[model samples]
Target: MHRGFFGLLALGLTFAVPAAAADNLKITGDETVVTIETDDGVVDITRQKTEAALIGGVLQPMVPVPGVTPVGELEVLDALKTKSAKVVDMRTLEWRTKSTIPGSIHIPYTEVAMRLNELGCSGSQGAWDCANADKMIAFCNGPACPQSPTAIKAMAREGYPPEKIFYYRGGMQDWVVLGLTVAEDMF
Candidate 1:
């Protein structure tokens, strides 16, 4: 009985060990690959590959969204420090309450088009200062999410200048990932 139990334990470890190791995904070039090692051999599993045409035999970042500037954590931090940007949170009320980038105002994506003035743009042109730059920026969950991008488009439809609008593509995901401060109560 003891010999059979030990044999089964060993068999289980063989399968479990490789699975745990393979959970470490590798990103090489534009593809996501999972490499697993077992007694028999190594197995390569390709989960996804980004589709992009090689330009001059070299890879480049994916095509950017038209009329949107992607801002990183550093840029957002700078903008907050200077008070240069009117940061808007495109997340829903639930997500905002849980955690959000500090200093971003709560503006659900659905209301952005009509609430341009409320967000900071003053006039019918969505103008704060005609002579100066636009400071309105919006963000939501992250890259895989569309809330922020949708809000930006809504602003554009409301006659907001594309150049004035900014998109914090990383949003809450990147903010927390970088250990940035999150505001729970205030917007």
Candidate 2:
């Protein structure tokens, strides 16, 4: 019974020690050092030290694409008000059915490739038409989502000029968060 109790204690200590140590390791370290212990050997990650940059003297990690134009909710609302731009909702049909921006066109990302011609652009004439009067802006769920980018890329590949394509990366989440009006009826 003494030997069994000691074995159980050892087992508990083996598991608890690592977890307790891991909790103490700060993720904000200049060198994100990681130590891994395996049955084979102990692996030290000291060489993986990364220099962290300070934003205003505090650590601020860089985003994948910095300075991305965040189409603000106010901009979208203004677009709707002024009727200066065509807002296309790239949300899925189910999402569109639930709610969307008023005066926005519904075009699901899945169907964008097939319905490229319906965008009413003259760029299909075999040259990029950045000057086309029918400019289009795409929006999806939000900045973290990629559906709007996919739709924009599809439009560009289908002869729509890149200049005419605007991405509203802030998307529906920002619109709703800003308390902007939403149309429950599909357009």
Clash totals for all candidate models:
0, 0
Q: Which stretches of candidate 1 lie over 4 Å from their true place?
A: 1-65, 122-133
Best by lDDT: 1
lDDT of 2 by residue, 1-187 (tens): 4656347556674332333333232334343446788554675543211222111111112221232234566677777788777788987887787778889988898777666555665444334443453666778776545677766766666666666566776677667777778889584
- List pairs with backbone clashes in candidate 1: none
How many Å off is the CA of 42 in candidate 1? 15
Query: Which digits, one per residue and each the tens of the lDDT, describe model 1 over residues 41-142?
Result: 676654321232111111212213466676788888888889888788987787788878777778898877656777556665444422343676777776
- CA lDDT, every model vs. true structure: 0.64, 0.61
Candidate 1, position 18, lDDT: 30
TM-score of each: 0.61, 0.57
- lDDT of predicted model 1: 0.64
lDDT of 2 at 96: 83
